[model samples]
Target chain A: MGDTFRDEELLADVICRLIGDVRHVAVGAQSPIPATAALLAQARGGGSPYVSLLGSRAHTFFTDGARELFDCAGQGRVDVFFLSGGQIDSEGNINLVSVGDYAHPKARFPGSFGSAYLYYVVPKVILFRTEHSRRTLVPKVDFVSAPGGSPGNVYRSGGPIGLVTNRCLFDFDRARRRFRLASVHPGHGVAEVIDNTGFDFDRPTHVPVTPAPSAETLALLRTTVAPMLAEVYPEFVKRVFNVPAPSP
Target chain B: MPLIAQSLDEALAPIAGGRLLAVPRESSGVAMAATRALIRRGIKRLHLVTLPTSSLQADLLIGAGCIETLETSAVSLGEFGPAPRFVAAILSGAIKMRDATCPALHAQLQAAEKGVPFMPLRGLLGSDVLAHRPDWKTIDNPFGNNDPIVLLPALTPDVALFHAPMADRAGNVFIGTQRELVVMAHAAQRTIVTVEKIHDGDLLRDPRLAAGTLAGFYVEAIAVSPRGAWPLPLPDHYGIDAAHMAEYARLAATPEGFAQYLDRYVYEKRAA
Candidate 1:
């Protein structure tokens, strides 16, 4: 890989493509990649689909406070949203509550922030976890903050459509209740993903390498997305793009 | 007589010890200066609720031994990193943690606002969050056929304490789109506010600001404390003091360091 862009930029490009032509995209807390993709989509899509980034002073349209995000998703207005877990099972169960037991045992992660609701309401809930290992991607999550799929009678309009990890992308099949290997990132192979992933997933005989970021996408990301992201994630912008945040 | 308190101490006087106090999210005006004041007072055994999530305020209170029980969805330092004191307390079983999902807290608060017994919410049906929460009950939807859903009991806090951009002489606060604060104020028995400044006229008189105004009827007391949400961003007003927060996250990582932090920044006032 040349010094053109980092792995995060490539991942953002894939996410931008996956976001394709959506009316509205919402990026949650602690997600710089998804936020980049959402902004990239907006810049490329001629601002057709709006992007609402949580914790940004200028980007968000909510006048009602934090709960408005929940209210909008509940009303089915939010088209795409991003979520990740400390532990994600093959079944798509996300555990952000804790790593061990409910009462108390081991690790304690940030509690679920609207995942239980957003997973059910948003049309496309993309699961993005940068770390793709057996420890992070387990056979079963110790605590399920939100289940991947629900019973037939359950009124769920949205759920995990795809899982984007450092190694590969896995498309979730709601009916099958399992993830199918979509594509592997560049320089990484099936064997690496297989070695790292704890849970079982279906894959084709020949898996393709995840596409690199296009020249145009890279340009927009560096010129437009980087500056926009500086407000919310200054450290990420500095580390990835080597761009200093604009002075307030 | 005006409801404005002469000093911060008088404003926070109603918060007596061991009461359920509701607060807003971290990004949405967090009342950090007020939190420092509470720490200075050495208030104890308070049940604190961070509407959906919190950052510095929770960490500071927990570090200072002010909070007995913390009811919130998540507590993180945002860009700084995981809340060290919060992590330490949870792991050591130092605080009573009522872990909950974000919407559940909002729904429960909404229930209290509506004076309803409970609110039925989607999700959490097969979740461990539901399993651990004995207060949350799953019942078959009376209207639907064999559809099971979880009902969250109303959590009516005793006091709603938060900071805002501005308040009027009438004591109406302008929260401007942070609707959960409205719900919190309506649900809690008493509402206390610390604002960056107080507007001259009645906030309700201006139609543009009226929708965002919380009437004086709901507000019990008000204190003017500029930069009240320092170290945390007050939406649409100022960005976060990242350096301060980073310093906090660094110093508060250890118990002794946290004590030193309290001594330097919290307990010991700088000479003017």
Candidate 2:
């Protein structure tokens, strides 16, 4: 508690590494972490893995308008995308629709945005949820906004590749249709993750700690990435990084 | 001759009760002032269709008891938290929800725009969303053996209502890069637009803005409402009024609070 915790920056670094060597990563609205990671990747890779942030004029490259983003994804131009939900299960089913019956839900979350389509079209759909607690990571989602994997006969080219939470990271095994615990974050243990997680996942015999962000990465994030993110998510940058809001 | 309304009320009058009214996403110029005007006029029983998603506008309408059936991918006051009124109404079984995905809504509207009966789209094949939607159907591709896909029925709304950055005297509204609005205008039988301001010259005359302009031929009515999308951002023009949105989210959490909010902000308008 002495020094300010850079949890968001650390998570962003982890996400940046997970992005790998992709051509284009398109981040949807309301996803600041993934957007930061995409931008970080761009900065680290010398302008590689183009980032197309929805709802950003400088970041997006769509001339045909909002529909163009969908068209591009349909044509397989978008490689990596981000999706999250109110509840995520062991099998990677996400629920952004409702918490109870479809007719009369006990809790109604914002309806599924593009998960139905993006979860299938984007090659690498990284599911990110900041809170990885029992309530959020459930045994099974009440509503399947999008399934992690589809039957072999079904035409699905995209699904969950990995899930990043505040506690840890889990790599999705498409064939097994289960999440395998990759690593727990610093100051967090496997037991803590297991205790907090509502869903069951396979764990390695010896779990390792998620690597802390390097000094260079932290510096770059504070300087370069923060400003770039400010262009799109000014409030997030201000609240998270203490960056001044850019003048309109 | 285009149908240009003299006032905001006149522009919204054609959107009769229980009409399937299509509106743009929250990011693209939300007609907030027009929305308040609609609420003040007691517009009821609207089948509200948010192109892909919505925020305050949808929640306000739902809270005001104006929406009968809502078809959209999602509706939330982004960053502000969950849409309280939408959640309250849904929990109470007050409104019918035709749950949909983002691309599905856009694809259906495009199908209507192209004058087609239905449009085939990828995905939703294995999702439970398809299971609940009895209206949607899946079929094996006629050309390819054993290839299946989801076909969405065309969504031709009765009226396309939205706010634009500007509109010319000829009724052409300049939407800039928000192209989804163009699709909405084309798919709906009638298009009613509220603009922030009116352009002096014909919008079509400027070749640069022409491509981004929605020609007056598809427009049924237009009204000039400066700061039409107030409390909401107009995409590339201004940012969202976060304080006001936060206040709405806070007030809409409870039914009584929501009514009081409507009373202060919507019902009994104080002198501006």
Candidate 3:
């Protein structure tokens, strides 16, 4: 693989791999990268995995409205879902609500959407945060929109499987309630990740660099996935893939 | 009796200051034009509910001080960024917030649609959203030992409001594939709709359109407001106005800027 792909492409490639061979992948709003990955995965798998972009009419199949997504997840229909947060702790707890006190937050993020429920139902929840820094990877999230792990008695079929950031990927251990350094993205190192991280995590002594997207994968992303993504994330596609915005 | 209103203001007349108003998510045809009208009217103390989630509609209402309390899953501007006005209001504690998850809000309204006292839902265990909502109670599954589930009280809003592509003279709204509006209409005491145009024939008269049409019986009022979901997409009919939305996100970032936005768009209404 050459150094031709952009960071967004790299992140999308990583998320596609994280998505694995799933039956249904639901990408939420404000998530261009995950939506790209889901489309890419769908294209690559000969359309085996159904991709549902929440806000797109062309991408989604549901006619039952917004509740259908959650209802389907509850019935164990959705296999992979993506969630991002304002802050994510080592324990995989995500905070999409606020950064400070519940009553008077210093910085209030968009209120929690489906994470509270989808995080519990979707079997593979891949956490993605484009920004990798101490502020974002906090020691403890100010609010837990959804816990990374529930108690033994809780009826949880899904939780965080791994986290993909701009710098690296961290695989979550649900039973141990911790994260292990999986692999660092190209141009980033363990030292850089450690320096920027606020919470502690276990990392292998020899952390390999994340592989870049294959030329074939890049071609598929640019030619196929880029057009499909334009339906939902036109601006992102215009910026990352240089796809021209359709005439209004 | 004719249910059509002569004007947007008259259509929104039933939406009193303190009444609970239910609205659909952005993709389901948000009543952006009506929202501006509400702001222009200086409607106050509205308890706004977003069926699953919201974006510009909620932010604009919150910024205009029309909202007293907001009950929703999330409020964002999609690709544009975090809703500046909504974030500021939350940080300042200007309006009461009842933070809820997407499914919970849907279930609450579904309970009302079914005329049930409450609806039992899975998930939301060990979440702060559930913790903060004391009104939401957890009861053990009597059918199973040691299994507890959360029961959400039925949420019957005073009015349900939205925009759509078309409605018939008889008040039958053609909501297309956006079925959430149906749930919202079914749960609310009265349904108010704004459409791009009035269809020639009854929406229910067409077999192809009947499945997606909300019966005229549920709709209390209808107003013709072309491009009613402006800046936001109305699915099928129009795409989002990217430049306008980007401009809105930039201009609405500050209080003075937001006021400027209100002056240019809300106060001085654009000629439809």
Best by lDDT: 3
Across residues B29-67, which tens digit of lDDT does each residue of candidate 2 receive?
A: 888888898888888999999988999999999999999
- For residue A120, model 1's alpha carbon misses the true position, in angstroms, by 1.7
Residue B272 error for model 3, in Å? 2.0
What fraction of the true interface contacts does model 3 reproduce?
0.83
* Model 2: DockQ score: 0.75
- The DockQ-derived docking category for candidate 1 is medium
Which residue pairs collide, candidate 2?
A: none
Better of 2 and 3 by lDDT: 3
Error of 3 at B270 (Å): 4.1
- Candidate 1 lDDT, A1-248, residue by residue in tens: 34476889989988888887778899998899999999899889887688899888767877776778888888999999999999999899999888776667588887888887789889899999999999999999998888999888787889999999888999999999899999999889999999999999999999998888878788889998899999999888988999986553
Error of 2 at B204 (Å): 1.5
Which parts of model 2 are misplaced by more than 4 Å?
A1-5, A246-248, B270-272
Q: TM-scores, in order shown?
A: 0.97, 0.97, 0.98
**lDDT for each candidate structure:** 0.88, 0.88, 0.92
Clashes of each: 6, 0, 0
Which scores higher on DockQ, 1 or 2? 2
**What C-alpha lDDT, on a 0 to 100 scale, does residue B84 get in candidate 1?**
89
